[model samples]
Target: MADLSDATLDELREALAAELPAQAAFDGWKPAAVDAAADALGVDRDVARLAFPGGAVDMIDAWFAQVDREMEARLPAEQLSNLKIRDRITRLLETRLDILAPDREALRRALAILAMPQNAPRAVKLGWRSADLMWRMAGDTATDFNHYTKRVTLSLVYSSTIMAFLDDESDDFADTRAFLARRIDNVMQFEKVKAKWRGAGGERPSLTRFIGRLRYPAI
Candidate 1:
């Protein structure tokens, strides 16, 4: 195999991603999995070190990115165009989980890793990425405070539903879908309350300021 020293990060991620899942089956997202994948690809395991110095955490991030790209391509844009916004959000989130159904064990392990205290930032990043992608695909073009608020609120909903999904064994993820629906409804209710409050002569200025600073990544 040619040395990957000159390769772009995107190229390296593309190459390693193909073998990572199989390796994770044997080693559960440890550096050993990365090494094993490297061997199978006929590249030195250290190549992964060059590609992602953060080790398993970085690999997990790349895996999520890969799935996000797949979800984008596989979802029919025209079909989503006519749906209501709430329905659009539900479809995008459900489609993502469905795409991941075949990799449940790998996802369980990834979630475990992200649950550790040291991995909190990565967990937040992953949630934000998924939520932001959902909004973008739902045709949201907001560039103001609404943009950040939507992403932050969705991130909370996404993260909680993912935890519930990890142990969901129902046929077709019925239980998980119910849980997700409840959470989405709660967020919608909250948004409605906030809108009413905003219309009530700015009675909740402090609350608005607090929510305004919730950070979201640049689109």
Candidate 2:
């Protein structure tokens, strides 16, 4: 994961494309899944970046998000085959979130109680800008957009606790919610990072074989 920052964003993105398979060959970007996928790809630390403003990063994000959306709920019977690869990526992301249910039981309880909308499951919304994470990964942003999103939107379980709507639950939701918030905060502060790119969203990749040890230390 530390190696990701050293690689140019472009290089990392390329690697992600190669490994994720676009949820059945669809266009793909799922915000939560993006960085995780990049981490899993294990891109080289020294990959070069072009580092210029006006790069199509936002467009890139949109492209991948679109793919993810199209892939949502895809099934052989639901023959939406013409769906762009990008649109299909949402399902992949959703699938990953499915993987989280067990780790965060509160997440499952929250979804069960909330009766989460079928169109946008609770898990997906928790990390779905589905694209804002790049700047965070690159350590380029200045705003805490990521943190801000957690409290109000579908909160993620960064600290292994409760989150968002789950706060109302009398059982363990509050503790879980608080802990998750703490986790995200701890990670952010440890990394000394912001959610948006303050300088330029696009920067040249570091070419000097640097394995960035995640600016933030896990709590």
User: Using lDDT as the measure, which candidate wins?
Assistant: 1
Pairing residues by index, what is the TM-score of model 1? Answer: 0.82
lDDT of 1: 0.78
Residue pairs with backbone overlap in model 1: none
Query: Residue by residue across 6-27, what tens digits does model 2's lDDT show?
Result: 5556655544543343321232
Q: State how far residue 179 of model 2 sits from its true place (Å).
A: 19
- Highest-scoring model, TM-score: 1
Q: In candidate 1, what residue range of length 10 has the lowest lDDT sum?
A: 210-219
Model 1 misplaced stretches (Cα beyond 4 Å): 1-7, 39-44, 205-219
Tell me the spans in candidate 2 whose CA falls farther than 4 Å from its real position: 1-11, 14-43, 48-96, 99-219
lDDT, residue 178, candidate 2 = 44
TM-score of 2: 0.21
lDDT of each: 0.78, 0.36
